[model samples]
Target: MLNHYPLWKYIILILVLLLGCLYAIPNLYGEDPAIQVTGTHGRMINEALLIQIKNALTHEAVQSKSIIWQSGEILVRFMNNELQLKAREIIQKVVGQNYIVALNLVPATPHWLSYFAAKPMKLGLDLRGGVHFLIEVDTDLMMDKIQKQNIETLHTYFNKKNMPYVAINTNDQNRIILRFRDESTCKIAYQSLSSYSPDIVIHKNAYNCLTVDISTDKVYKVREDAVKQNIHILRNRVTQLGLADTLVKRQGDNFIIVELPGIQDTARAKEILSATAMLEFRLVHLQSNIYNSIPNDFDIKETPEGQAVILDRKAILTGNHITNSVANMDEYNQPQVNISLDNIGGNIMATFTKSHIGKVIATLLIEYRDSGKKDARGHSLLEKHEEIINIASIQSPFSNSFRVSGINNIKEARQLSLLLRSGALTAPIRITEERIIGPSMAVQNIKKGLDACIWGLVSSIVFMVLRYKIFGLIATCALLANLVLIVSIMSILPGVTLTMPGIAGIVLTLVVAVDANILINERIKEELRNGRFAQQAIYVGYKEAFSSILDANITTLIKVVILYTVGSGSIQGFAITTAIGIATSMFTSMVGTRAMINLIYGRKRIDRLSI
Candidate 1:
């Protein structure tokens, strides 16, 4: 009666263990070497594309287990690494630049377990072998853009306020210069501008020219904002790639570090991450003197179809105004991109189209690519290219939504839609450093870590069984249950990545679990030696040992929490595994072992017990 548990307690224990077993089944299925094919530049991936990929694989004599289309990507699983490698090369040559072919590992989970959304925990970069890139943000271009915007803003404010100034222009040193008629007007303008723009400093010079300079603090803040914006945009774009366990974070003031676990396509990853797919809508100048020297407020650009066109300097609408975009077919069955704009952009489009019903409007696609040079500061030179992706005459007034036609193919339409959906990069970024972790290294790491865990577990089990006899064996069984519960919990939890440090945490957890069992067994022995009955000793031993075990686990949990709070990457992975282990160990050691002991020894009284 002293150590007996209710029937409901046994039911709950059975349910928990069964659920744990269910979730842990996927981990045993392991992973297969595979290659993923994704559309680039807005190419759509569907079931139809699978045939093409399969054909390419077959042409190269690459044996594949299966080919499946999932989440807008094609996954081709290979029977061996050699076939996977051969298939990658053949597929790249066959598909060309329209599709991005990357090497990856696909889960070989059974259909039954996958139906429940049970997946093996994702491995970290070190364990899974992936690509790591250190990208540098071009702060110079960001500052230049900011300065130009400020100059335009000041000019607009002066015009709206009816200030008396001869000319308003930006100097070579990036200062806004306002040339006034007299010192009185200059002084008044300086005071008004200073009061209005606290982020800048205004000074009047000898020639009555007022100079507005951005404050040092404001400049630093602009740089920081630019870096933060780039990081956010990069993350959004990378998410479109459907990568799991990917990490994108700031490494320093102007550098971002991206880790793509299980990603092997360094070239494609670099291209996607560095692409600045900014869009601009401009009106084509139809004046008769178009061949003459262009006005200062206009630019000359080439259309995608190879025709040169003159466009207004100011864009009527930009990528920032785009709210939604999708790839679709026009009435003629030609591929096109349908775009929806925000309210302000909608109003602007409606007004412009209403005034110039027959004028041609151009959608400019601006991209930045590495220029293969480095300045004095060691930053890569980036060149900007602007081309008109679409040019169409306005037949009627419309707002909010419009379609861009004349796309060469469906792949181009898909690429445009993806770029519009992902939004534009705030600034150009270049990869300064890139490192690829091969699959062989990852396999070696996995083998070594698993071996270490197996040995640690075996040693813990042997010690537990040798020390306390039957009770020790019961503890060992509970320890095994703890491991199952930990793995199950990790498998079910979203975004949890397992790493080498996580393996160490699991090994450490086994030691702590065995220690807890030892404490309870020792307490039971003490109670038995003091002449207590077997059932009473079991109850008393558990009751006294609970406090010591709780206190110890809580202390370690506090440390793990701190570690998780301050750490990043693999350190956090370690903390997560340890924290989960501590929790599951407490449940199994206290409740699991107690339940087993109650069923075996609680119902009967004995003067002598094995301890």
Candidate 2:
């Protein structure tokens, strides 16, 4: 009974090992170089388009390994990267502008394993090799916009409070200038504004002019928030676009670093990642004559169909207040996007609609695009684009939620919904640096790392077998199980990316496991030398070794936790693998080896131990 295990224990161990093997099976199939074709602008992938793509590839004498239509997209696999590249050009020309053809490395997992949602661990950018971008946030523009908004807010506040001010505007230095009739009025206004918020600094000059500026700490906070918001929005955009294994992180005060593993469409990635698109709700100036010179407060804008309309420059609400949006069909079968706003936006919209019943409100879609030109400072210039997407008369006083109709198609509506739901970027961004890692280089790195792990494992197994004989063989089996369990757990967990440093962690973990086995083997030899029976020595050896094994692995886990907490990128990857390895190694080296020893030696009387 000293070395024996219960039936339930054996059953649990068997079940765990079986599940590990089941999940670990997917990694053996590896990946295939492939091309993914997804529709854009509401274009759906139909069988006809699929056939067109196939025919285009065939006409060019590019043989594809397999082509399948799945999840509203077409996946074309190739035996090598050469065919994949050739097929991409052909597919792009065939699909035209309505579709996006992107190079990808898709999993070659079998259908059986996929049915259970078993997948291999995700590879990092260094191993899978896709695209990396360093983007700079336009903090200058963000500050300017914030200042303008603050100026408008102050103007509204002064008007509502009946303050005596001659003019309120921003000057060339980006400071809000408020002119009062006298120095006394300026002092009074300054006190009122200062009491409203501690974030602003107000100065009164001798000429009855007051300078309103943001505090230094507030300015720093605003810039930091803009960069952080952009990082969140970029992550949402990439995820919605179905780019797997994507990473978006802040690099510095005004920069973000994005890594897209297994995605090769740099242009598409750039277009989505840097887009600063938003919607605005503005009142149309129906009384203004479009044929004449427009008023200074109003601007002439156009619809997508080229119809001109006059609109107020100031917006009642912007997309920043939008909390949720969804695309749906109206009673007339027209495409529309239903939008929800936050509390402040809801109150503002309610007040505006209640007074301006029957007035025409327009939904304006604004986008900032690269103008194909650089500024004097060598930065790409952005051209602002505005179009009136929808216009409708107020049917009632609605707040919080509303729908915008007049969309061109379902695709456009869905796209608009996606952008709104993902939240708008606080500032524009430009890609300052870009690097692409080809599939060949990624494969080379993966092969080298894998080779190192495999060789390390084999060497450990040989040493254990030669030193401890049959008991060493038992330890080798546990080691193999530990490896399988680690792979299976990594596969099951989400967002675990395997990197070279992660492989190093796995190697170190194997060494730790071997050390544990050596400790147990040496203890058993000591017990045998003291004239103990084989089975009793085995029991005593394992009993005394558990505490040491637990202590050592717990210490390792403490370091892994610290590394994970303070690290980023590759260091975090290493910590993840080490943590997982420490856990599995503890189990296999002690509980697992004990279970096997119990089955082989627990039931029989022996004169001497093999170890």
Candidate 3:
């Protein structure tokens, strides 16, 4: 029976979904074609060309800028293969200099045009492709921070014990091995350090010399954690940049493959992809008031503590406490930022605001430019010359939802809204690998993938029809339903990049589901031949099929679990579709078959159970 829901409610839901799709469809375009004007190492490796290119593209004045572009691919393979440079000499000369690479004029067609055309994404070497990368996440900086945190314990202890130790400036903060101006002072510093040290095990060797060693395993774990964190942030960052349905997946020990549809805005892609998006909420302390006067660049507000002055930099709250953010307006209607927080964040903001009412708090804002202009020296003047509107008063006392205002116009408002929706990574995310496929490559992949899918489906149908006959048609119906569900899911969901691996996963699941129907049909036939009636055979066939289906699906589910747990990006896609397919398939073949049988023969007197 079709349970009818209220028409109004269903219509509202559909409208919401449709509106969301229309709003987000633009992001599918990916980054624009970056106009190429200069190469660092070639005759093109000079400011003159860059300036000329900028002028030709946008008659506006160019400014100093650092626009990072990506090939949408790793600069080198895990084996350290040097990235192919259009002009190596130009690249070397241009790094940290006033020049930017032009991707539009690059001889190759970019990777994203076909992607926008809704082409299937290509796999990296790790997936359907061949090559793979394994990067060793850098942890020197983190280790150094830990070392400093540990050393500070010694400082606190020494202050009480009157021990003098000299500080040394080393890049690694992990080893805060201070040199005691005198050996006697070392003993006092060591003694003081132990008092506050967490699990400090001081040991003396035969020479009676001190050995200060940290938990190497613990430090290693921290680095590993940092790498994982970095990976997640990188994923978020790439997504935020709207990389045209990009796939940033984990491969092996410490590797990720960023696959694009075609060649991409490699330069800007690199800048956005390579960096981490670290966001912190600093309290604003106003010295130069903004109430009577326009806001200043920087200032400080006196807090009750008097020592810790809040930074005047615009900051209502950090991203951590954000429950849900949407683009909306405020009470006064001056385009204010309206932010609703969770219980914890709400409590904090409420208390802070209540205590400091009628005061100023500017949320610290950082906007990374999608693209920028270059000056005579050929530097990205994105931050210097680019315009950014500061939003405030959005933070409020609610755990439900909120929106930020102060968008001077619709354009700025739209960008900010996208940032919140996609989420700003805790750290800057960079695209280590970027490639924009040309139209030719995209068309080829589309044809190849489509052919494979057609052949697979045809083969499945032939087998099903030949073996089960009438039952095969039923299974085919379920299969079609499965396909519809999968496509519908892909359309409704964001961050779903249809790739070759994803297709393979779907194919694999479809095969498994077909097998379920076949098994049930064969069981029913065996029972009927044993002299059971049609309805009785159907009931028994379904009952017995349950155990086998459970056993099979459970094992397959285990593999999917491992795939999701261990696999990175593309593998994740496989795991997701596979799991969803398994779940939905079971329903169609089992529950759906029962419904069909009931509908077909509610109280029939059918004899032979033949197709």
After superposing candidate 2, which stretches have Cα over 4 Å from the reference?
153-172, 176-198, 202-211, 283-312, 329-335, 354-362, 370-380, 387-396, 406-411
Q: What is the lDDT of residue 73 in candidate 3?
A: 17
Give all candidates' CA lDDT scores: 0.84, 0.86, 0.52
Per-residue lDDT of 490-587 in model 3, one digit per residue for the tens? Answer: 54465565566777887887888888998899898989989998878877888888999989999999999999899876688888778877886786
Model 2 per-residue lDDT tens digits across residues 513-588: 9999998989999999999989889989988988898899999999999999999889999999999999899889
Clashing residue pairs found in predicted model 1? 41-415, 42-414, 42-415
Say which candidate scores most in lDDT.
2
Cα lDDT tens digits, model 1, 401-421, are 987776777777777787787
TM-score of each: 0.86, 0.88, 0.50
Error of 3 at 202 (Å): 8.3
| Model 2 local distance difference test score | 0.86
